[model samples]
Target: MSELSKQLQQLQREIKKLQRAGTVPAAASAGDESKVRFTAKGFVSLRSKLGLSAREMALLLDVSLQTIYNWEAQKSAPRAEQVKAIAQLRGIGKKQAKARIAEIEAAQA
Candidate 1:
């Protein structure tokens, strides 16, 4: 068998072993807090859900406006700290979002 095919078979065997051992895959093992994988589409959807403009999201996430655009455009992803912040923001309602924005503005003033 080819090296690639042999490697694939080995990986399949490892997956089966993991399944038999009742251990979840590494990708799926990230608990609730880190489970929300950052994707460009998800970033855009969250911004829309919170009714936030790109600038607003930048302020909310404490990133630059250009970073927000980069995230939405899929040209780059948020850093680990930003991803954690985004995960926290994902759970807030619109009212909470507005309140947070107000708090940020107040802090800046």
Candidate 2:
């Protein structure tokens, strides 16, 4: 392969290594509070799962509406405690977050 191609391959391999080591910033293991990756859609899912509007969720989370909006827009994420509260509010264990994701995906099918 060309030198550039080789470098790209090396980078890809490094990324894979990081991902396997659970080092990717967005890839969090179940119940790993410190590694939780909160996406905008995740927030929306929790809100839907709990039948909560944005305003209601903001109230319950004790955060400004803009903060919630920012999260949903991928501008920012909640802190660990907030993530735990969201998990609890959705009637989910931290490990079960993936299951909820599956449910969300299936519902859209």
Candidate 3:
């Protein structure tokens, strides 16, 4: 009834239509290991899924905290090199993420 409810219903209808058409949603179609398209929402989701703080993610990505914030806020996007790093990160588990952070820190030290 409300505007938000109407929007949600419309989205549901669209999703069903896409499903019937055999089209995978971009967010759900990361099956290809060779390439990935970076998106602000995907970046945020990956970071959250790994349980990393913004600072930890920044260190892992070899970028500044401000840069992470900017990406998550959709203020700017990662460069091609950074997107490659992000794709690698997205495919790893939480334990691997921690190990990577440690590896980066050890290398820096």
Candidate 4:
């Protein structure tokens, strides 16, 4: 790869690490928040990737079901702290996400 490509990959890794660490910057604007890789379309895509319903995703993320809908509708963005949960979602697959949902539900019960 070109040096620029290598640098971009490195930067992406650092950003992912920070995100998983819940160190995303405070929300600025809807557009700016998209920089955190949590855009409405991406959110929808990720939820679909996990094969999760809005309610299940809300449970996993510890947010209200409506919040999940709002996110996918671009009505709002996840707060910085909430982005940590989304980051976790990015690291997991359909099975893992379902397992996580089960864990969260068990804990709630």
lDDT of 2 by residue, 1-109 (tens): 5999999889878877775654553223243566555678977987777666676677666688898889999888888877766655544433444444556557659
Question: Would you list the C-alpha lDDT of every candidate in the order shown?
Answer: 0.81, 0.66, 0.81, 0.77
Model 3 Cα lDDT, one tens digit per residue, 1-109:
6999999889878876775554534334434534668889988899999999999999998899999999999999988778877876765679878998999999989
Best by TM-score: 1
Judging by lDDT, tell me the better candidate of 2 and 3. Answer: 3
lDDT of 1 by residue, 31-100 (tens): 4545657999988999999999998898899999999999989898988878888877776768878888
Better of 1 and 3 by lDDT: 3
Of 2 and 4, the candidate ranking higher by TM-score? 4
Worst 10 residues of 4 by lDDT: 22-31
Please tell me which model should have the higher lDDT, number 1 or number 2. 1
lDDT of 3 at 92: 68
Top of the candidates by lDDT:
3
Where does candidate 2 have its weakest 10-residue lDDT segment? 22-31
Task: Give the C-alpha lDDT of model 3.
Answer: 0.81
Q: In model 3, which regions exceed 4 Å deviation?
A: 1-35
Q: Say which prediction, candidate 2 or candidate 3, comes out ahead on TM-score.
A: 3
Better of 1 and 4 by lDDT: 1
The global Cα lDDT (0 to 1) of model 2 is 0.66
Worst 10 residues of 3 by lDDT: 24-33
